[model samples]
Target: MAFTNNFSTSFHWWDRIFGTDTKYREYRARVKAAKKAMSKEQQLEFERKLMAQVEAEGIVAEAEAEKMSLLGGNKKSKV
Candidate 1:
């Protein structure tokens, strides 16, 4: 029973590592195939959408940081 438990645990560890690598490769391949399948106009549209998403995330992050700084500075002043 102990040996079986140890074997199962080790198997899961290796499986997780290899499984993630396989999944990443599959994701990259799918993305490459989809990009190849797109026309120039479609590709440009996709890039524009991606950049918009990235910019939105950055703005959100900056706003969060500014809010946290304001809250932190206010607390220090009250103390």
Candidate 2:
């Protein structure tokens, strides 16, 4: 997955990755609302943490893909 600075576009990448972009957006809306009371700095920090999490998940996904390929025919398609 590509790392994007824009949250909307970033979620687009995630939607492709998880096949549930819409659901993720709904969840994000709830989370965003909960954090709406925070300062701009806090929001930025939250976004940064979320991006880091997405990055880690991407790495784990890539590693899993590699491992699965090693097993030959029983391949599961990656997002």
Candidate 3:
């Protein structure tokens, strides 16, 4: 025998009755408005800033991993 879950089905039914989540809709609207309002140069600058932030986060993560490896925190112990 197999068990099936209907949680998503009920949640979707409620969503249809009450409309989609408000916060998500508002976030999408804000992003759409921001994109629409940004000039070409502004958009390019925003993209550059976003890419820089992403690269910075990646570098930070890599440094953390390297530090952990150096401290032997990532080693697996055999029982």
Candidate 4:
């Protein structure tokens, strides 16, 4: 699934006009609980693995391009 914590807590909204905020709040709480349940070594391993998965999925490049575009940066070309 796509990332959830970006626009809002649960759903992105124009304002308080719409949202299913509780699910995100609950999700976040669960994440925090799980993290707390991990030992420090386990937490480090978990983060490393999660980041590796994202990179393997090619999200790192996509997110980098999106960030550059948002900042009015031009795409870089390799020569």
TM-scores of all candidate predictions against the true structure: 0.46, 0.50, 0.43, 0.35
Q: Model 4 clash pairs?
A: none
- For residues 21-62, write the lDDT of model 4, one tens digit per residue: 444455457557769889989877876776566455446545
Whole-model lDDT per candidate: 0.54, 0.62, 0.54, 0.56
Off by over 4 Å in 1: 1-34, 70-76
Task: Tell me the tens digit of each residue's lDDT in model 1 across 31-66.
Answer: 577689899898778767755665665566556666
Locate the minimum summed-lDDT window of 10 residues in model 2: 1-10
How does model 2 fare in lDDT? 0.62
22-56, model 2: which lDDT tens digit per residue? Answer: 44555478558858788888888887887677778
Q: Least lDDT summed over 10 consecutive residues: which range in candidate 4?
A: 1-10
Best by lDDT: 2
Worst lDDT run of 10 residues, candidate 3, spans: 1-10
Tell me how candidate 3 scores on lDDT: 0.54
The CA lDDT at 14 in model 3 is 58
Question: Which segments of model 4 are wrong by more than 4 Å?
Answer: 1-33, 59-79
Task: Please give the ranking of all candidate structures by lDDT, highest first, separated by commas.
Answer: 2, 4, 3, 1
lDDT of 3 at 74: 67
Best model per TM-score: 2
The C-alpha local distance difference test score for the whole of candidate 1 amounts to: 0.54
Alpha-carbon runs more than 4 Å astray in model 2: 1-27, 70-79
